[model samples]
Target: MFTSRTFKINKICEYLLNAKVKRCYPKHILSNRSVHDVIDVDINGVKLIFPNVWLRDNCQCEQCFHVTAKSRIIDYNNFNVDTKPVKVTKNSNSLQVTWDDGHKSKYGFNWLKLRSFSPKYQKKYNDDIYRSPKIVWHGKDFYEICKKHDYKDIVSSDEALHKWLNDTSVYGVSVIEKTPNSETAIDEIVKTVGFTKRTHYGEKFVVQNVTNTSNVAYLSSSLQIHTDLPYYEYCPGVNMLHFLVQTKGEGGENILSDGHYTAKYIKDNFPEDFKLLTNVQVEWSDVGEEAGNKFYKLYRAPIIEIDSNDEINRINFSIPQRGSHFPGSIEDVVPWYKALKLFFNLNKKFAAKFKTPEGNILVFDNIRLLHGRNKYEDSENNVRKLIGAYIDWDEIYSRLRCVKVKLNLID
Candidate 1:
């Protein structure tokens, strides 16, 4: 009686550790469905039915998976779809499967529970709740928590690097201070994040007030808040601007607005306009000439992009880059402009203004943060110079995930 009671208590503790699975699948079991050619496992409340071939293919043994590299070595083509398990048995905390071809595979309960492809977990994933954690900020208070990291610490310490990456991921922006005021400093910063995502502008673009400007960014004019490369089919995901020289005078502040926050406010206040912007496709193009190089590109997409869960994923609002030709009927054109006007006004209202000093680097999500520059005069002495670059989210998130793994922030 004592031994049985102790075993029951241990099982209860284990279930408590896996509360999510235990709550969903209270009384779980491991069994084989020979007729279906699959293995069945009932996690506390969740039922997982995986194909036999999938089980064999995902085996993590030394022969199947490289322990060092943590990658699969199994030749998937060697396994047939009709593969079936000859026997299935449950050990203390694992399920053992013996294949018809005399292959054995072992999967811990926790691993199987996490890797389960059940409808419940699939629904959770589709719900968009498991995405990178985000902390939305609007107005002046946003500046209070703007995380800043030293350039040296970012390159040297994984902890500091992770903090910067995590802050950028969650807040859509971050500042890197004490950056070396050299042309190559941007490369080091970009390397920290991953790599530069080159565009038609080149691997790196220069941002400075010039006599005869090559692009709007080169001219001393107020740039309306917008995302870069809205004209590209696959717009660059991350943007970084390292200030080599801070401009003198009153009107050289960089404007940054949380596109996600602006869109959410519009959705809540102007539902009709929000719906129109989300549905209508607008043409964005950049046709220009620089150093005898002619460039013209166009792309059509809704100004506001929403995912399946009705959450804002992207905001493409570039007044200068927008093409003259608008899509849809004449009646829809007026509503589209109305929606654009409302959105633009909201962006201006909610934008945060700050002057980036020399040796400071600003990193933001091109997809979620709308950035612009204030008009400034180019005196011989107080000229502004900034080096700009881009990198995709794949690289940024890869680095973030790597750091998170090293820091044990995720399993």
Candidate 2:
């Protein structure tokens, strides 16, 4: 049934179809090419371009890379920046390279794709791996979504711990109910996340009216909503306040406002004021002696800090600790004051008033939330006592990532 001429025609047709299939790859996927300083790799239709120096430094050989340590053991001092790839071969799941120095290196397709020097990949990495997304909220609406976790569950279960940290990351606040009233109870809660951050007030501080008060918070007065430690260059990230004893008298209710929500409102309604708050640098200082140690801390920064991405990062506002000296020009004084007044008024309007029950731990992101309390009478019969501590964001987020990994929420 077959002839020589028919067989030759069939072979020609098959060869043509195979060639056409090879050319069918999408144009967006770059072909393998080496430039003067970089190599363009095409992995299953995804384009990944890598620099020559970077690829050489990231060689995956046992001699150049330590498998146990997951670090590069190559000598940087003897590294050749101009190293060239003498040969390159692509497999189904990896790329093989032979360097000019006869060094053989192989890289997994997924690994190279993750480290792609492309804007799209970079943004994907940031969104998926860098940090959790923040949810800006108003007090009135946030109150309904604010769920309290049991103290025992938070300390005992990883699921509860992840939920608390995740909520705090998104909403910037969380509450724990049924906490022990003992002095060391705060320590147990803090140890679950990280170590206690010590300040001039010691590892932890107490908020109660005293005979000789060093801090304004120790006085029996209505405090304005504000962030703590604006004077510190590296302010504490989170604040945990345990209501050990609540006052029987009227007042002493907590006031809370989301600084990010207020900032967004200002940016939308009063753009000029928002710009002033983010651009004008002011001095925040604290002076006096506490716990038999004298210290004066001062830091200069804008009230509203804007990150490189032009997003509100943190709010620094403390009326009691603000410096007397004005740093702006004379003409900028009234406008700055007006802007600050508007900000304070907006904060008050958006504030949530609540009375945290005794034996409850109210935790919040100090950098993102403004907090204060009403004046309460402190007598022998009724005394208001609160134990407070701080934990850095780095520690909290680190624990969160580890918990997520353990729970298989992320790879």
Candidate 3:
């Protein structure tokens, strides 16, 4: 939306009418228009600011003006040299130069209504290379960890699967619809894709029969939003829940929050704690349900991760599942506890719960979305059982962004 905003446009129009090589510097006649002001420069050095859109077509880059591999041909005749020139600068030593775009070529002093040019050794720009992304472990080892599951094909089309992934990755969650019931269906959805069923604490993939529950209180209980565990290695970044049966209750709702948002909010507003979470790796563990044995493990992950371009990219949140603090773990030093409290409070806003039916696969951006449920009344004899699965971070994103590129939908 950056644009020219001056009344000097009429001055440039006058130059276009004359179309002479007399106009070069428009500063004298510009009527105080700023250099940043998009203008029309006449051969007479008169500044007549022009509309912004009119110049987008004047690009000399290969994307707009197809160049040969040699790039030696100078299409000077096609240059729209009649436009008014803005303020001009010179090389620190001798020749008078014009404008500010890193170009050092000496020309006919007619750069009035055009883009500034310098001796560009390179002609193309690649934004992806310049970005400083924080995501690590995208190399061979990570692939080896994922490639182990090994299946012929989870989805029918590579292109189609890529498209479907974006819908789930960008948003906090995605749904797979029209699936029929059975353990076979669950395996078909996740098994071919090679998802590791991450289990820690006591909730990895707990399945219960309505008829077998000894605690009657569980039949009517509501689940709060929590990570699968606060302790465990990797903490399983993908969480999927499939409904086998719909409860007859009138008000049970599912909710989710984006850790990406919570992390970014804190990074920008609470620099200190954001610093803490990224600076140190914490330990997490699960106290076993068994009376005699307990299990524990640890991991190193930042609460927030940004891409090379510095966009809020990913989140690793499952604090409750973390093992015991590591030896020599730095104790909380700052008023960061207050900021941590506030960050989780902010996550409270992303809660979104709704009724789910059989055959729906609710997939979450395990690194980002916090899942929970609302309380509902249920018949004592008929409790509900939920089926679940998992997927990885890299595979899902690769699929989603590929589609976004084709559809021109990525933000």
Candidate 4:
């Protein structure tokens, strides 16, 4: 038989695990004091204090918070900031309070526990902690990891589709094998996640050597490592390349390096370079006129971007697409060059080379993985052709969430 203390502890644990909270009366109270405009209450050896205004504003009743939308409907101007609670008493599984305004508020102990500001519940912010699902990969070992799905399985079975998306989300790259060699095939893959992210290049772009090439990628030349469309304000999230023709080739192997890993390496070894790269903003532009289509896209952004929490969010890097114009202080030119060189060297050192044969599709996070191809000359007898498309992470993330819910992975 469990004691009252043990039962209460078990209940708290259950709430933490599944949010299956059981409302039980407070058994023991060490302290209950009205301090200023707040009420400090101690129960089960845990100290918690509730502010009068905060308690009134956070009432969960239908009158205060809408039951359908679950949003607060209380007028902000109605509550007094310095209002005092006339009485604070413990009710079943809650703290019942009467404010000086004669307004009654009842707060669930479980709800308060969830939003506790106690030293025991507070977690010190750590710079090393990654908030998103940006997993870093390194070395040739990354190539060894092969999470491939059949084209039919992905389209037919939700389980297979979810697994593929999960792998791409977690690893930032995944392969789909035995796909048909057609333009619609790549479109199908994009539709599985979301609609095609139409860009200046249109809906679908062909990756093949052209007679008059506007982009360097169109020609059969060695392309340096880069993420596509760095100049776009909202860069494409995921890139899908479906190889329709990958004949005998000596140097057409794809070169990929995890930008997150490269960033981490620079931060760990060359902290100065990392800081400079993250702080210095550079101009990226795409100027061209091909087949009567004229477009010049340009945007200024830092090589490394950090989120509000100071975690590395995205790496906007494209050497060929970088504009030559220097917008900042002339003194920053030398330092910026040095920092960029160090970063490029680190990326080169960590890059992995792989080849996607015909009937194989490559999908990777455009924001996380920097991709390129080795130089290969055009052959009259053998030709290499690939169709590519883009999809935003918003769609992929939504699909992932839906899949998880369907599988009952989350409540």
lDDT of each: 0.79, 0.83, 0.48, 0.76
Measured against the true structure, the TM-scores of the candidates, in listed sequence, are 0.82, 0.85, 0.51, 0.77
Q: List the candidate 2 regions with Cα displacement exceeding 4 Å.
A: 1-46, 62-70, 90-92, 118-121
**Global lDDT for candidate 2?**
0.83
User: Clashing residue pairs in candidate 2, if any?
Assistant: none
Off by over 4 Å in 3: 1-160, 191-204, 207-220, 289-294, 300-302, 305-314, 322-334, 378-381, 397-411
lDDT of candidate 1 at residue 387, scale 0 to 100: 92
In model 1, where do residues sit more than 4 Å from their true spots?
1-57, 61-86, 99-103, 117-131
Candidate 1 lDDT over 205-232, as tens digits, reads 9998776775787887898899998999
Q: What's the candidate order when arranged by decreasing lDDT?
A: 2, 1, 4, 3
State the TM-score for model 3: 0.51
Report how far off residue 339 is in candidate 3 (Å). 2.2
Per-residue alpha-carbon lDDT of model 2 for 64-103, expressed as tens digits? 9999997999988789987888888877888888888898
Winner of 1 and 2 under TM-score: 2
Candidate 3 residue lDDT tens string, 211-298 = 3443221344555555654344455667777676666656566767666656776778878877765555555444443323355455
